[model samples]
Structure formats: C-alpha cells, structure tokens
Target: MTKMIVGLGNPGDRYDGTKHNMGFMALDLLAKEYQTDFKMEKTFIAEVAQTFVNGEKVFLVKPQTFMNESGRAVKPLLTYFNIDPEDLSVVFDDMDSPVGRVRLRQKGSSGGHNGIKSILTHVGTEHFNHVKIGIGRPKNGMKVVNHVLTKFDSEDNSEAQDGIFKAVDAIKYYIENNDFTKAMNKFN
Candidate 1:
C-alpha cells in the first residue's frame, strides 16, 4: 500500500514560489484542499500531513532539507514506515517539459534532478513513483540552476498553477486506483 508522498524543494522564504519549489507548492495546495496540516517532524527532516484517501492512510511530506539533500529525509521515512520503493511517490520540478505539463512515472532514473539524485543515492534505488512538474527551460542556454531558482514571469504563472493542479489530480488518481499508466496517460 502506498503510504508516503514526498515533495522536493529548498526551505526558506527566499525559495518560496520559485520554480524549484513547485513540488512543495503543489503539495501545499493538496494539503489545504484536504484540510490537513503539516507538522514538523525532525525524524523525517520534513513537515508531514496525515490524511485518509479512499480509506488508505497517506503521509504528505515536504522535506525541510535543501533540494540536493532531499533523499536524506526520504530514506528514513521509507524505512520507518516499512514502505517499499513502489509505495513511495515523489514530486519534483522538471525543466525539460513546458510549464503546463506534468509527467507521471512508475519508476525511473532521476534524469539528473539533484533532489531526486539525492533521494536515490540514499535509498540505493531509482524504482519509485514520481510526478514531475514542468517549469520550462531557460530562454537561451542559461544554466539550469539559475533557471530553476528564478520565479515564474506573469506569462508563466497561470501555466505553473495549471501544472500544480494537474499534479494533484494525478496523485489522487494514483492513490485511488494504483494505476500509474492511467495517471500518466491522463496527466502527461
């Protein structure tokens, strides 16, 4: 049974609303809509919100650790909850996809996402579900780091919001049906 949903991002006012924090923003919206509150949990190095969906217990998590260290928190949570890799889902930003797109995967490599890389490194596997929210690429060949940390412009804000909502829907579908292919076909 799926037990944990982790959102990857850096923590701090400065990072809020940045493209890199899209995962956290999406998860926050989900928590708010579900009327759940995330409480600080040092053991997991994250803020966690608990709720039941379709009669299944779900842990909504936003790691407090910086982006590159996200896995440090995730590894322990999986171990503590006795959750297998298949039962975990991670949400994170992707620069390759357009701002309005969301991609869902059952299991795959990190695709060079530092946050995901960190998680995989700690957990020693890449076989886990993931929802990748698109933030769009830079105008030119700008560095990915700078591009991801930048805030969305007025033109991109609406698309970003759309992506977040779609991601939430995909998560819901995943929990309700355990059908990753359906979520991917519907959302991606």
Candidate 2:
C-alpha cells in the first residue's frame, strides 16, 4: 500500500530551525537519507518528494499553509492521492513530551496543537498515524508562542536533533511493516 508521510510546519525562513518546525526538520532528514530533493507542488501548496522504502511507495510532504492552517494542504493531498487515513502518517511537534522523545501512535487527539487540530478537521478523522517530535514544554515564565518559535539552546538542540532522527527511523519502520503498534513498541 502507498503511504503519505506529512511533516507539518509553517512555511518560511523565519520559522526555520525553531522547535515548532521539528516536523519539517525530520522530513528534511528523511528526504536526504532517501537521496532526493523536495519539489514545490503548488496545487497542494506543499513541498513533496517521493521515494521507496522497503518497497513501499512513500510520499513525503511539507505543508506551506503556516502552522495554523496546515489542513488546507494536507487534506487536499490525502484526497488527491486517494490515501486512507490508515495509510497516512504525520510528523509534528509536541510540547508535552520531553525533548528527544519521539512517539509513534496509531491515532490521538491533537493535544492542543493548532496544526494537528487543523489536519484533523480537514482529514475528517482522528484515526490516523502520527509521529510526535517532542519539543518539551515552555520553561516557567516563557510564553508558548515565544518558546515554540525560539531556537533551542545548544544542549537542547542536540536532543531535539536526536528526536528527529529517531522519528525518521520510526517512519521507516512503519513503512516497512505497516504496523503502528509494532513500530511504536520498537521505537517509542
């Protein structure tokens, strides 16, 4: 079965390397590991690259609708590709989990993430696959907006990188096995 792996992030250089863009970061690594470059698909308003992993066709996507309206791009791509929610996987940032922690789930609520919320709205279901790249909660006294947009400190940056890499591995495992429970058991 074909699968779509979406990386949700705001579109622009200003958001680059921020904690909120962990999804995009992980996609970049996954694409690089697959030896490909993203081509902007204006029809979907997203960057897309295609590759095969363990004989499964994988389409990597990065929505360009900013963080709040990512569904506009995601929903269209899912429909156009005729991919079921069961065959769709997404990678995104999560503040509740500690940095460097990556969790793969068959499905879940958005947990207050606007991007994931929008995606759920457009996709019309919560029963989809997801890989959450942990960004950690804001330190006391820091605002959520500021904390998510800010680059991590030197120490935390390394951990976040590790998390993204782990997410990449999880994606590969999920594609190869088509088993979220097994992938989560091994990687989460």
Tens digits of per-residue lDDT, candidate 1, 64-180, equal 999999988999888998888888899999988999689988888888899999999999988888899999889778888889998999999999999999999999888788777
RMSD of 1: 1.2
Task: Judge candidate 2 at residue 43 and give its lDDT.
Answer: 94
Worst 10 residues of 1 by lDDT: 174-183
| Model 2 lDDT, residue 73, Cα | 94
Residues 1-188 of candidate 2 have per-residue lDDT tens digits of 78999998878889999999999999999999889899999999999999987777789999998989988998999889898888888899999999989988899999999999999999999988989988999987899999999999897988999999999999877777878889999997
Clash-forming residue pairs, model 1: 71-119
Q: Give the candidate number with the greatest lDDT.
A: 2
Please list the residue runs of candidate 2 whose C-alpha ends up more than 4 Å from where it truly belongs after superposition: none
TM-score of each: 0.95, 0.97
Candidate 1, superposed: residue stretches over 4 Å from native: none
lDDT of each: 0.89, 0.91
Mark the 10 consecutive residues where model 2 has the least summed lDDT: 171-180
